[model samples]
Target: MPYEVQGVVSRAKGEPVSLETVIVPDPGPGEAVVSVKACGVCHTDLHYREGGINDEFPFLLGHEAAGYVEQVGPGVTDLAPGDFVILNWRAVCGTCRACRRGRPWYCFNSHNANQSMTLADGTRLTPALGIGAFLEKTLVHAGQCTKVSPEAEPAVAGLLGCGVMAGLGAALNTGAVGRGDTVAVIGCGGVGDAAIAGSYLAGARTIIAVDTDDRKLEWAKGFGATHTINSRGLGQNDVVQAIRELTDSFGADVVIDAVGRPETWKQAFYARDLAGTLVLVGVPTPDMRLDDMPLIDFFARGGSLKSSWYGDCLPSRDFPMLIDLYLQGRLPLEKFVTERISVDGVERAFERMHKGEVLRSVVEFS
Candidate 1:
């Protein structure tokens, strides 16, 4: 039987999201219905509300979520009801070229529920990042649901589904931070802080956090940044030079641009040592164009220039490892959850986020 539940929806850009009656269909082939426990208010959600993501109005707004499996479709053999799971957007299709090449993280064809969850009036709703999770229950491909330790807190565990995972994966997977490596992360938001923490976890000896926000800098310190640069008063060169000075006058081995603007990307481009890596984990806007590019600069600055997608995470692999680290007190996932909020508080959370008021305001469902 199909279930009807209240879900947050963006009826129009720049309009407040409301609780709408969403019709969730019974699981079809390869799908599962998850009873969402908690979801995080990511920048992507705000982008959806602002129509920054698309014209997909009446969008089912949340994606960073953890839940319990309520039902599994006919062909879904691995997942079963009552399983504790973290919902992920990327469900790699094995036949894709990326997956065939064994790089499932770069899978060109990802899967979602074949059936659509609709509005009460039968209007189809577009799910955010292919996983609409801000509701009481959501339908998703079974592959989107990865079982994790039931002991983990829903709020913190759900974060691994998005920003936090992106940052950590940027450093550990993309940047390949190693023992004694000098790493610098630009922007000290939740993602940036997570990169710093990931660098520390990967055994980086010097993790430099650069941000204009003093409060965010403080947060970065708790995430294991050995040094912080207040970029507000300093120009980009000054900030880069300061980081270089901190890294023994040699630029860091890896520099991550968590800010995602062209200015920050350029800063990261020039801030790393010769042959060092630069990982762009921040999302970029469509209108933003690169300028003043010299082909010589690209070649002279050798090493990988990469963008991290969902931290290149395979939920089945990364989530449990991160949760274990969290449980063991090695990773401070709890520190990232600055505030716990109810589902109705999402818009307000975005307001606070824009004001730089919180690291992460997680929505806890009763």
Candidate 2:
């Protein structure tokens, strides 16, 4: 039997989201039903409501979630009911070419629930990032459920499900920031700070955080940034030069563009030392086009120009490792949870997020 659960949904473009009863089907083959304990409000959810992601109306919001496995479908052996898990969007297929090449992080095929959760009117809702999880219960593939230490709070563990992971992985995985390396993260939002913290974890001696907001810069400092640049009073070149000045008048070994925009991308391209890596983790809109780049710039840079998808995370691998770090007090995952809210407050949380008032407003389910 299908279960009825309350969820946040955007019925139309630019309209206010509200609580609605969504029908969650029972676990089918290779699927699992999760009793969501907490879910975080992310910018992507806001983009969906604003019609920024696509024209998919009546979209189910929320993806960064932590929950307990309520039931497991037939042929699912790795997970069972009572398992505490953080929901992951990327459920990698081992047979994908990328996986076969030993690069599972770049898995071309990921998994989601075979079943659909729809509205009372029977309109199929597109689950944001294939894991709409604002509801009290959500259905996803068994592989999407990554078991973590239940001792960790859901509010904190769920973050690894998305943005935070993106930031950390951008630095640690894509940027390959190493011990004593000079690292600069352009943008001091949650993702940027995560990159800073990741740099610190990777043993970077110097980590520079560049942002326009003073509050966010302060937050970056708490997350291991050795220096902060408030870019509001500075031009792109000025910020880049300031970053270089802090790094012995030479650009950093790795520069990450956490704010995905053409201008920022260009800045990141030119902000690094010769042969330094540039990692773009920010999400760009469809209307945004790349042009006017000198083809020589790509070759002249002499290093990788990469975009990180979900921080190129293999959830099964990274989630547990991050959880262990959190437990060991090495990663301050709890600091990212700026506020805990109810599911009804998601719209207001989006407003706070847009205004840069909070890092993450997590909706805690009773």
What value does the lDDT take at residue 90 in candidate 1? Answer: 85
Candidate lDDT values, in order: 0.92, 0.91
Alpha-carbon shift of residue 162 in model 2 (angstroms): 0.4
Query: Candidate 1 overall Cα lDDT vs. reference?
Result: 0.92
Best by TM-score: 1
Clashes per model (N, Cα, C within 3 A): 0, 0
By TM-score, how accurate is candidate 2? 0.98
What does the lDDT come to for candidate 2? Answer: 0.91
Candidate 1 colliding pairs: none
